[model samples]
Target: MTSKYMALPKGMSESSFDAAIEKFKKALGAENVMIKDEQVRPYTKVMMAVPTEEHTPSAVITATTVEQVQAVVKICNEHKVPVWTISTGRNFGYGSAAPGRRGQVVLDLRKMNKIIHVDPELCTALVEPGVTYQMLYDYLEENKIPLMLSFSAPSAIAGPLGNTMDRGVGYTPYGEHFMMQCGMEVVMANGDVLRTGMGGVKGDKAWQVFKWGYGPTLDGMFTQANYGICTKMGFWLMPKPPVFKPLEIQFDEDSDISDIVEFIRPLRISQVIPNSVVIAGVLWEASTCNTRRADYTTEPGHTPDAILKQIQKDKHLGAWNVYAALYGTKEQVDVNFKIVQDALKQLGKGRLITEEMAGDTQPFKYRAQLMSGVPNLQEFGLYNWRGGGGSMWFAPVTQARGSECDKQKSLAKKILNKHGLDYVGEFIVGWRDMHHVIDVLYDRSSEEETKRANACFAELLDEFEKEGYAVYRVNTAFQERVAQSYGKVKRDVERKIKRALDPNGILAPGKSGIDI
Candidate 1:
């Protein structure tokens, strides 16, 4: 298949590429292997404007069966070709559904989406990589089951495997999805399959319950790394609470963030706010709610100083918003909500706004976390960037380092401003750590904007690293830069792990910038 974006590297041979494609088609079946330009084109680009020319896959394969995935991996291993796995391709702000390396085959697993088992007695479900939150919710509702699963507010199209693989957190008490994962079925680079926890031992009931193995806890090794392809996983689910209440608390001053975070830390550790917490800055709130307002859209290339002026004039500057939920029996929710309200009042701030939804109040009951409500930012179609374009850099930050976060935000805004780009999304994930997602939104049609966005992102990474921040999740485009952020020791350790698991270095080469 030929594509304008498919620019083969120098010294690469057409004969070699064609042979690789033929071998892949033979192994995975021609029907499952996509060599047509139309099928391969969309898999070439991610969400960011960082040109798709660098990581255009030679083929896009949709594996409907684990046996097919194993066959494809074997063929790729023999040829020493890289493979990048993607599920649903709904990973917005980061890279959409694109491989991190060029000439690699994209393993699209959306077709394998299925909820294999939902055990109400154990409150756990075994799901394939393709299962999404919306799908799970609909199925449970249809079956008249009583349970709640945590989900991100962005696109419900994201797969359960993709989100958990990235260690993405949600808005419920069980917001830390990866932590709840008990077992995983991974396809290694050499085509060998491995299962973690009790899944390795036949007929063990603890396969989806206990996380520890007799030797090592290897579940974390698969996350945020290209060591293997996760086909199946078991995750814990929450039982339906007798009563759920969503609450919101607004703070008028920026300084209040530190106090608020401190107040919530103990509560979180005590399992009071077990799900997750979000402390959204005022500018972030304004961008999502009032984009149509003349105040925001009127000025193109508005400086940070000007935006701050507008925010202050609008009485929204330094407005810190928090979302939290209360679960359990009616008495439990009532008692918890009162305690939270009283705590907020002591801080000289507290307000409750009624949510639009009534039944199953799980979404609105959270005041410290932001994932429950429908992610309003996604409504603008900002996450979906057509063509080979758009990108996001997510990093974890300490909530106590409010000053440092402010500095980082300032630096990011200044860098994007210099490049004539917008710093679109920012929010807190864990109560004490911040997930500052900077969306480099630009039209793929504009070559200049795309180039500027890439350069600006590179520069921002440098600044963020110098300031002692680390990336939680990175795209294949900036793999090298992200790797450089980690110190020599950590990088060395990561390389060793990669080499041990993938000796041939044929799985996701150039991804995460590990040479192993």
Candidate 2:
């Protein structure tokens, strides 16, 4: 059953490619190995500023079991083929499921979805790569398991395995995804299986509970790198709280961002507010429900400040919106809520929006849902802000200081406006660090807009680096530049590790720009 001969992997002729395809088909069945044009189209959708063909997958192989993944990797190793892996393939702004380089087979693992184990006593879970947040949430609810999940904004469609492996963030107290992970099961490039942390000990019961397994921690390396395919992983789940109260604090002026950061840091560090707080911009709050720029104005590029003020007034939102929560029993929540209230009150610029007042609002509802471990897709509405469906998340990390937050915001806004783009971004305040996430939204259909967006992204990197600021995560297009933002010695060590693990380069080649 052959459709048409398309491009093959590098250094391989059509016959050799056909032979590799046959081997894949034989290993996973013909229905699971997708080489047809239509079957591979979904895997080619990329949001980065690069040619679509450059990131297209040559074939897509879906495996249902760890043994099947091992067999497929063995075949790719034999043929000197590179294989990119994805769990649920819903990483929207970060290239989705597309490989870093083109002409590689996508080891799509959506078929291997299974919740292997759930320990209610320990509040731990073991799941396959395909076990999505929504699936796990439903399972816990159905079984009346009193455990909650920590997931990103795009939670319902994204899997825990993919998000956790990427070290993504959420809104809950367990917002730090990777920090909460306890165990991981990886399928190496050489077709060997490994269990990290306590999972290495045979018949060990603390694999998922105890993270440190006696030696150097290897789980951090596999994350955000293409060293191994994580077939299964175990993560700690947030136990059900006796009480939950989510709060929203809105400031009237954009300049109030500095004070908000200053005030919230003490609360966050003091555990008065145990969860990660989102200090979102005005545009970010509005975009959750506002679909088009034309709705307010026909002006192109960044939305005018007057128009933004109008949006803030009409939407009853703030120049900056802060979403945080209080957990524990009713007594504990009341005490902590008072502490949070006092913190905001001292700022003298923040207006607290209680849960009752913010009932079913844009940023408020979504933030509450995330903090409670309920998955929702309302965050995707940001893609419709400028139309044309172009997006790239430019995330840079900084100290959770108000002054640093203010400086980053000002610089990013200036660069974005210069490029004729709007600053639709937010700051998720960690205990001591903050992730300043900005979505570079533009109209991909317009060639001019695309060109400017690309230039703007490059300049953002350069200017940010000049200010001693470094991006924490980036889209697939600028991974190399982001990697080089650090010194050469760091990348040298990464390359050495990549070569040691994947000598044949059969794993992801350009992932995070570590191609050795």
Candidate 3:
């Protein structure tokens, strides 16, 4: 169909690339096949501090059906062409919708946004890849259904399918997205459909209720890997409780972080604090209210300490901010709130802000909204902090201990400040683990700044790995480097699985750095 193939796939000539895409177009349609340079620009937007050219997609194939996806994968396998997949293409701060490798076609599943089923009695919903959190939330509201949705910070546009596939976290009891999922429908690289959990059996009414089938479960293999393209997934939704209490514990001193995690661990593990506790540094909370660094200073580099302190003072925030909520009956909330208040009071410094105290402001307002299943775009303000449109989330997982949190905070802060960048990060306390997430935000427009950001990121990986701290998730730009931090034996096993599942390497060649 196209007389030209300007951006051919790797090792492909104009004629060959055109022929492959023509076959893809036939499976869907010429209108759905995006090959023009201008047509694929939307898929090239990368928020990471790297050159945008490397992330540009050669073409984009918008598949509206599972059968169409199977046909497209077959075409890619036959032509030895790499393929990248994006659910809604709204995965900001990671890579957006860009393909992992250049010249690979993006299989956009946004058009297949179908809320196939929502069983209120079972609190389960089967959704296609294109079904976004906002879409699902609106459906519940329009139908006047009494259910809550646990979603990431950027909940308005990000989809549950993509977030769960990437193992993204949220702020509710159902915070672990993947664990909340009970089923998945994936389109394999060889053009075959496989259903995990109870979906494997035909006419199985318990497909959405039972997570594991009769044999060895196969759902974990598809997550955060290049193994398959998930077309549909079933996620468990939270039933609305009678009482909801959002709590905030703001500490004044840096030394207080040494006790924050330790104090919260028991409460979190015991289920007294059911939701994931969000421990945010002052800068993270500040960005939600303050738009740019120049609002406090005119310096082209990192904001001065004095200015940051002034921002904290002026904004009425603390050195660190902790947000979590108590949900259940009214009597249950009162008892848990008193326990949380008494334990957190041991620090003898923080000011506990109740829901009544916080009005229409952030980070309290936004955190409260997310905990209640209300979707908002408040987290997008992080990109506006430096004003250069660059951000990379450096997330490292550690044990839920005070010493570990202190060590990670100290090391990360020193490294970040040494690189002339500020530490805009937070810690989401899971049941047994703490995810220390750092946003390496920088000015992409400045070549010098981008260079520093890249070096800072590389050093972080190197130094953290030496300390036995490994990032749980990373953007596409540093997947290769981050992959090595886990060691070779693990990498070898991943590569073996990739080779076995996708021999042609046609599906996301360098995703999480798993390739032949």
Residue-by-residue lDDT tens digits, candidate 3, 1-516: 553543568888877887887798789999999888788888888988788888888888899999999999888988898999999877677788998877888999999999999998899999999999999999999998888999999899999999999999999999998889999999999988999988889899888899998899999888889899999999999999999999888887777897888888999999999999999988898887755787877766566778877877988888889999999999999999889888867756678999899877777988999999999999888877887888889999999999999999989988888888988989999999999999999988889999999889988988889999999889899899888888899999999999898999998999999997
**Candidate 3 structure lDDT:** 0.89
Tens-digit per-residue lDDT, 1-516, candidate 1: 744325332334667666767887777678887766787787766656565666677778789888888888887776676777888887766777777766777888988988999888898889998888778877878897787777665635766678988887777877777977889999988788899987888778888888886898899988888788999999988887776666566676655656666666666666675557666655555544433323445444433555554664574334666666677888877777778777777767645544643233322322222333232224333333222345565454545455656676677778888887666545554745667666566555667767777787788788777777777777667778787777799889988988998997777766677769
Candidate 2 lDDT over residue span 1-516, tens digit each: 543533467777778888999999899999999888889988889887667888888898999998999998899889998998999999888889987777888999998889999999899999998889999999999999999999999899999999988889998989999999999999998889999999888889999999989889899999989899999899999998999998888888999888899999989999899999999998887888764678898887788899999999988888999999999999999999887777667667778887898787677888899999998998888987898888999999999998999999999999999999999999999999999999999988888998999999999999999999988778878888998998899899999998998888888888888887
Clashes of each: 25, 0, 0
- Flag regions of model 2 displaced more than 4 Å: 1-6
Full-model lDDT, candidate 2: 0.89
| TM-score of candidate 1 against the unseen true structure | 0.88
Overall lDDT per candidate, in order of appearance: 0.69, 0.89, 0.89
For residue 252, model 2's alpha carbon misses the true position, in angstroms, by 1.0
lDDT of 1 at 365: 29
Clashing pairs for model 2 are none
Error of 1 at 9 (Å): 7.7
